[model samples]
Target: MKKEKTIETINPTTGKSLHHYSYMSDEAVKKAISKCHKAFETWKEISPKDRAKIILSIGKELIKSKEELAQLMTDEMGKTLEQSRQEVDLCVAICNYTAKIGPKELKTEDREMVNDNKGRITYAPIGVVYGIQPWNYPSYQVVRYSIASLMAGNGVLLKHASNVTGSGKLLEQIYQKTDIPDGLFTVLVINHDQSDTVITNKLVRGVTLTGSPDAGKNIGQKASAALKKSVLELGSNDAYLVFEDADINLAVKACVKGRIYNNGETCIAAKRFIVVEKVYDEFRDKFVEAMSNVKTGNPNIKSTQLGPIAREDLRNELHQQVVESVKKGAKIACGGKIPNGNGFFYPATVLENVKPGQPAYEDELFGPVASLIKAKNNKDAMRIANDSRFGLGGGIFSKNEEAAFEIAEKYFDTGMVFINSFGLADPAMPFGGVKESGYGREHGGFGLKEFVNIKSVMYR
Candidate 1:
């Protein structure tokens, strides 16, 4: 496939052109990689404490430009302005968290050898790590990996989604405002083929991606074939289980927030709501009512609860999923309609009688659409939650905290689980998923080591 010469970003809210960017040529990308590798030579020698100092400054810079950055993300990807601000806040939190723990996490450790010789383990910075990120949570997705990798002394490169190209360039500018080196945190405005060339570059040591499973497979394969390490945080159809003993009101409220937050374009958003037969009718009634009342309109408005779907094609794809699911016997209790308007708006939809062999039940509906599945009992609810091929994160809502914890730990078959709440990534806690949702973890000090070379040295 031939690489395009230019990339254009459109405003999803208005469907108008916001900016046009020229893709970096192959020579430009190679030079960028070489520059990053050169910077890495000096950056890798810096102490973790010094790196944390710069990272701390980055957090301050992010807050200083929070409003501007937030608005740019809103204009680029159709996320609500307030949500964009919150995304900036999350990025700041990640920066703060990475700075606080990075020094200790990346510090060298002394250990005893088998023959009683002195042994030391050093977590050294690898070369430039390339990240291919999605448009959803643009700031958070970039900051999530870049901050940790920078703190670990590795140079960072980004290939942000084309729809959020402005966000990516703005982030690069934000990083430049801090003490970070020039090429240490660079954003490549290149297409897919150039990205492949980057992965094969000898200067690129590690790769990480946050996208769909198919994308993960492609990048993972390329990185593996090149013998470079990769970390993937793929998509998920996270289930929010409402057990028989669960509080119907609390479950409904949290599930609704989980589904609709970020306009329901989140990777870990509660897509599946599995309710026990005992309380299915009551929960379904209240859930459908809440979803029906959700406001959908311009993202800039303060009162809008749902924004445009980021792109026209994405909205159309979501509608097709709803249509296919309906054909497979799923019934739309509320929403499920694409609005006849200028913007790519998808209503907060709910599908009931959701069963296997339906897109609503099998695959991820990456929008404000909910799949309400009925389980015979608590055991059956667990079974349905664990039935999917993707296992990123899930939730177990029950009044008995202990029982929910046990389920989260023992039976959930996911990376992270919420007991009585619906929450996204936390800087203090480890985040990532298992199975097709992608391997490896991010956040909570775990991400700091993902791109580091753990070297062992012995002295006799």
Candidate 2:
């Protein structure tokens, strides 16, 4: 008999293993997919309103276990307990919002065809949707796609990041407590090879992933080969522009929040700060001072602003990016050194003199690191912001709301733009990107239709 491989979840704050899960066997994976598809057969036939009711009850289950799940998330991924709670809050909101709007969003529409014929457009569920989510904001990441898919009448499958396997399992448990049928939301504790096999499974219909561009490419290719639709929310080196007419205080505060939120591991968080020359000096000094004040410690503590890097290898990779950027002419304004510690902790860092060739300017530093770039003027700032392969999200700060909106609408080429404040995903807004950041929209009712088949029914 062969020994089964296992995936271990670690406590990023203590550098200790928290839990381990055995990888599902190929037979088990196949069975799970078949079971989910079997459930989808009945799930799809249920009315959207009935599906929404079941989906909304999942929120109640989540709230019941909010504290335990939040602790599990913090212990696994090193986000502060407060942030972990907030993640759960967002998940709950997702369930509530999905339930509120899903029936209407999925409602059949009537249209008039040529020659006075009647046409009906139906949004039908495809089948099982496989979601590959990241560790940061573990709960929200899982719920963001899962709830919408559930409301759309598709069975949900999750291959969550191995580092946060515990959170994924907990979510499965929560879903089981709901009235949803068994296997409707299955968590596959499997390795990369098994995941690929699952993607090619005939029972699986569509795929969605929130990971790096490289990972997206691999998964997207596999899905394409299988003739399955995929939604990839890839990486981004998002910029927050500080224009000449911006409020220096407001910009600095929001920029710091944008850079360090989720310990700066967020795909959409501001990684680059593009400031006009008129206010570069002031913004840099203030931003660095505020970031320097951020304390890195145990995520269980409420006052801690930044946590560990979620894994030691991730911390090392982030440090290497910082070192290479420095060697390439970017200067560390504050907090560049890797501290001697028990956990995978990296300090909140800001890089100045950031140029195009440096990693600080070129790559997505997936930790609490900030890149400060100076632009000649407001127009130059917009140009600098759009100068990236990533177009997920960006921010523009100006006291003039109309001008800021104009810049975001017309000039910022990303999928989402923040006018003044920094925020993560909202349940009501469309979230996704263009170019290398991946395509297809999630949230804001857009996600409900992502995996649905829009069929046109005509009557003569």
Candidate 3:
């Protein structure tokens, strides 16, 4: 008999183990894929209206267990209880939005054809969809892909980050409570090798992932080699531009939240700050002061504004980035050192005089560290914002809303843009990125179509 491998889920708040899950064996993984393929056969036969009904019921189940799910997320990951609750709320909202619009989005349409022929276009379900999600916003990331695939009449297979295995299982339990068919959604506790096997399986017709760009590339290549469709939501060092006419106070507040939200582990979190020369000094001072004052402690506490990094290695990696950036001429404005504590704690940090050659300027510093760059003017600031290989999401703070909108629409080379605020994903809006941030989109009405086949039938 082969020895079973186990994954220990550790709580970042206390650096303690919360749970242990035995990894699924290769045989079990293959069985799960077979089960998902079986479920998809039935799921695809269901009407879109019926699928929407089940999806809406899943939303209600999520709301019923919001508090418990939120606690699980906080215990497994380092997000605050408030933020975890918000993540569950967002998942519920995604379910609700997809339920409302999915039927219409999947309905067959009659189209005009040439030569006196009538044509009908139909959205048909593909086979099973495989998703590889990360630990940050555990619930949201899983739901962001699963719900849309479900509504589109496809089965879902989730390979959640090992750190959040319990959260992933809880999500599966919640789905089971709904009227969803058995095996419709399965969470496989498997390793990277198993994931590669699943991706290459003929049963999995499509793939979607939310993770680093490097991971995206590997998965994209695997899916491409298999002749499968994929949608990737990858990483970015998102920048926020502070124009000369921008409101400094609002910008400071938004940037603070943007930089540290989710312990600064979010793909779209603001990492780079480009402030015009007219407001650089004042903006830098206030931003550094606010970031320095942020309280990092137990995520469960209501007063805690920041929390520890999700793991010790992640904390160490962030510090290395700060140290290397400083060695390359970036100056530490505040909070550069690691705090003495039991957990993986790094104080909220800000780096000034950031230049192109520094890691703080060139790479995604996946932690609560902000890189401040000065621009000569609005145009220069915009140039600096678009200088990165990543184009996931960005912001522009300007007094004139019209001007900001124009720039966001015409020039901001990002998937999503915030005019005067630092916001996270919205269910009503298309979310994804261009360039190295990965291709394809999720949310709004676009995601339901990502895994569906748009077929056309013509008849005289």
Candidate 4:
């Protein structure tokens, strides 16, 4: 297997060089998987309590090393240092959440199997599990799969995003430094060829991917060809709906967090804001002012709220998307064009008069760009929000709590929704999408199940 000395990792914030990592080869990937399989043998023999102890130990180590991990992520992918730190924190919380609680959560029902038998459902390992994670939320995506896979007695093979090779390496460092068993978790430095081999390996019983729909389809199909269970979390065009009765200030703030958090690179970020026509002007004014106030620059500093697009092409692509949207008649309120500077920075842009026919109406914009749509009323807002094929998450702001829940029920494909607030993430909640946003969840109990098998045992 061939490997490189290093892949160029540029800081999107200032276009500075942040050197780290060479890609691993197909042979390396295979070897790593073999190691994972070997570890799984011994790891599976350990009690869930013991595994929990190891996991909790890893969490404690994470807390101690949080700053270094966060700084490494910032250097790797150029998100704000604070954001990178937060991503590390999210990983720590996940490790803590899954470790302290997973052993009990995996417990089965103690019931008789009817007149002559005892029955119980057991959560068991499914061999080595392969996780193909993306660049956005690097640590979060890694934890989303790794924590559960480790907790459920399975080994893990990680093939993280290419742009985030440093992050992948950093993860390897963190897990390796902790008490967590060595081969139970391995981050493959290998490229897709190795990733492909790992996916098809007999040792890998299951695979989960957090990427694009096309990538998900290809990986999913390959996994199916190998007869492996797979979970796909593609992308989304999540909507943020605001009603006439909603709190403008709060809704506007949440909307900013939803869209601008992670520099608007989240799959669950609010892509479209469907607002009631009665308050469209107010919402637009406030949203534009807020977006304009957002500062996009150095990721290592404390005051920077938004950073660069993770990569240069991504920034160019986002600029093109906005330019194309404007050509299709979507008005740019505050930050329409790229800032007159170098590096991959696109000022937060707002799209007004975004309609069904507009290009921005259809796809996910992976930067600090958001589209605003006007609706006649609650029903109209619902109609607009539900108009897209992707339904990963959503938000609705209404004074009426019952009305918010009622409206929430009306959203057929939404996995998570925020009422009178913004859509954010929680380790306790199940997160995923429907339609093009992809199927399956990546957090909480459901997330744990994605990498395991449910075995029903019975005895007379």
Candidate 5:
């Protein structure tokens, strides 16, 4: 008999194994998929109001278990306890927003037809939706996709990252406590080969993933081969533009927070800083100083502003990127070297004089590393910001809100943009990206329709 494979969950702050989980066998995975499909059949028949009630209960449950959930997230992924708590709050807000608005979003619409006939459009539930999520913001990542899918009356199947496996199971437990139907939400503990098999399963009607562009391409191909709908939220090196009229102090503070949030592992985190020459020196100096002073330590401590990277391998990869960028042309302004410590800790790093050939300028450095670039003017700042191949999210800082809005609306190529501030995802706004940042929008009301079938009916 073949030996069963197991995943070990390690504490990023302590570099010790906290738990281990056995991978579900191929037979079990198939059975789980079958069960999800069966549940979807029943879930689809339920009224939207009934679905909303269950979803609201889930929101309440999340609030009730916020402390425990936040601790688990911090223990498994090394996000600051404060940030983890905010993540849980964000998840609850998502659940609340989806529950309140989902029924209306999915309600049937009526229209008059040209041939003296009545036409109606209905949002119909698809079968099981398979999601492959990342470790950063473990709770929020799963909640972002799952709640919206569930509110639309579809079953959800999660293949969370190996490192945060415990958080995944905890989420499943929370859902089970709610009034949601059994098998409607399932977490599969499986390897890559088994994941491919799950995607190829006939019952999985739609697939969504949050990861790198390379992974997106591979998953897109697999889903295409199976004729399944896919939504990809890929990685990005998002840029933040600072205009000449920007408030240097506020810009520096926002940029620092943006760079270091979630240990700087966020996909939408501000990675590039393109500042106009008029205020470049002041902004760069202050930004580097602020980033340099950020406190890095155990995530459980409230005083610790920055936490360790989620994994040792990830820390090494980020260091390699910084080193290679320096070799090309970039100059380390502050905090480039990995700290001498037990945990996977790297100090907040800022790379200045960053040029096109450097990894800091060309690639996504998924850590607490900031790349600072100087431009001649506002036009040049926008140009530098739009030069990247990825455009998940970006930000602009200027005193004139009108001017910033104009540039963001007419020129910024990213999916979402912040004026005078930096933020993560919002439940009311449609979030996703254009170009290589992947396709489809989540949150707002758009997510409820991503996996639903738009059926048309006509009566004469």
Candidate 6:
């Protein structure tokens, strides 16, 4: 449980220290795990109504601290202050949404009994749940999985992203101050050493991770070795498909937001654009123009539309991807270069004629770069979109909603589809994907069910 002796959180926009967090020692890990094990039984027995009340109270606390949370997220992630506020709002909304909806959602489903004297099927907690959350969408990611799991009578043991360590501690503090039962929600700061053992421990029953494929592969393998359930949301290289019938103005508008939201760090972001041959040039031009129009500067300003990258390494990697794409014959339609600044600033970028070997088509560039690839027709567009290992979220834009739906259905690799729209998600809808994007849903009732153990008590 030895944590990082010193983990610094720097403002990606300023290259300055915002704060520092200490990692957990092995002794601390054992303590937290012990607490979680000690707390699970009581937490499991707590009525759903009481859990909901506590969740609502936590939600209210988050709302009250909205300004502070927003500022913190902005400083750590380099999202615009405006977007940061929205993230806080979304976090509050998700908490409230879970509080209000969790009871109904987690309510045991009545199953037909085979035997007259025995019982039927029901859902129950699987004991102490481990949540290894990501840095992007810090609040929502933790709450999305942990909150639902908590409502399902499972206590949570969280290992949030190292970069957002403060965010994790702050959340734990909020819950602790609310008098939420201890061990019900604990954020242990274990470093790389304990990562492998973190799941194998006997007290921990389940593990959920939102991270890279390589990380997911290792965790999934270890979790599987222990015969525990592992929910791996390994993310994706989300493809954006545009039919010729799409509204150029509308497509361009969404492209701007979709590829730049969260500094284009969203897992299901439209990293690749597949355009129908008929309107390829027109769509490319509009996309470039819209990208050029995005305002990039200080993240704290209300007027700023785009912000700096969340980390220097992320900025550098994104820059390298764009460079490689261009080198492979993709025409740099717009951006493709970082703005002159000390901050980790990569401007909104759009590239056209994105070759098959380029990152636009092959890799998931987690930044503000959009790659445009041309297709002869809808069939060809679908072919290009599905020609990748990742498949999380994608969209089809056409004036005809039916046609858009058809195209979305035609996409073989993706999980969620947006008809005549970008991959903007809702809390009430199921969000996940197929292929290398990983399995498991992250929203709606499906997300809640991810935390529950469906059991059948049949009497014969």
RMSD (Å) per prediction: 1.0, 1.3, 1.4, 1.9, 1.2, 2.0
Per-residue accuracy of model 4 over 226-254 as CA lDDT, tens digit each: 99998888888888889899989989999
lDDT of 3 by residue, 1-460 (tens): 5655899999988898998899998999999999989998998999999999999999999999999999999888889999999999999999999999999999999998987899999999998999999998889999999999999999999999999999999999999999888899999999898899999998999999899989999999999999999999999999999999999999999999999999999999999999999999999999999998999999999998888898888888999999999999999999999888688888899999999999999999999999999999999998999999999999999999999999999999999999999989999999999999999989989999999999999998
Model 3 ranges off by over 4 Å: 1-4
- Give one digit per residue, the lDDT tens place, for model 5 in 1-460: 6655899999999999999899998899999999988988998899998999999999999999899999999999999999999999999999989989988999999999999899999999888999999999799999999998998889999999999999999999999999887899999999888999999998999999999999999999999999999999999999999999999999999999999999999999999999999999999889988998999999898899999999999999999999999898889999999888688999999999999988899899999999999999999999989998998999999999998999999999999999999989999999999889999999989989999999999998
- Cα lDDT of candidate 6 equals 0.81
The per-model lDDT (C-alpha) reads: 0.92, 0.93, 0.94, 0.83, 0.94, 0.81
Residue 37 error for model 4, in Å?
A: 0.4
What value does the lDDT take at residue 214 in candidate 6? Answer: 83
Kindly report which residue stretches of model 2 are placed more than 4 angstroms away from their true locations once superposed.
1-4
The residue-by-residue lDDT of candidate 1 on 320-366, one tens digit each, is 99999999999999998877868788999999989899999999999
Off by more than 4 A, model 5: 1-4
In model 1, pairs of residues that clash are: none
Q: Provide the global lDDT of candidate 1 against the true structure.
A: 0.92
Q: Summing lDDT over every window of 10 consecutive residues in candidate 4, give the lowest-scoring window.
A: 1-10
Greater TM-score among 4 and 5 belongs to 5
Supply every candidate's count of residue pairs whose N, Cα or C atoms clash at under 3 angstroms.
0, 0, 0, 2, 0, 7
Model 4 reaches what TM-score against the true structure?
0.96
Better of 4 and 6 by lDDT: 4
TM-score-superior candidate, 1 or 6: 1
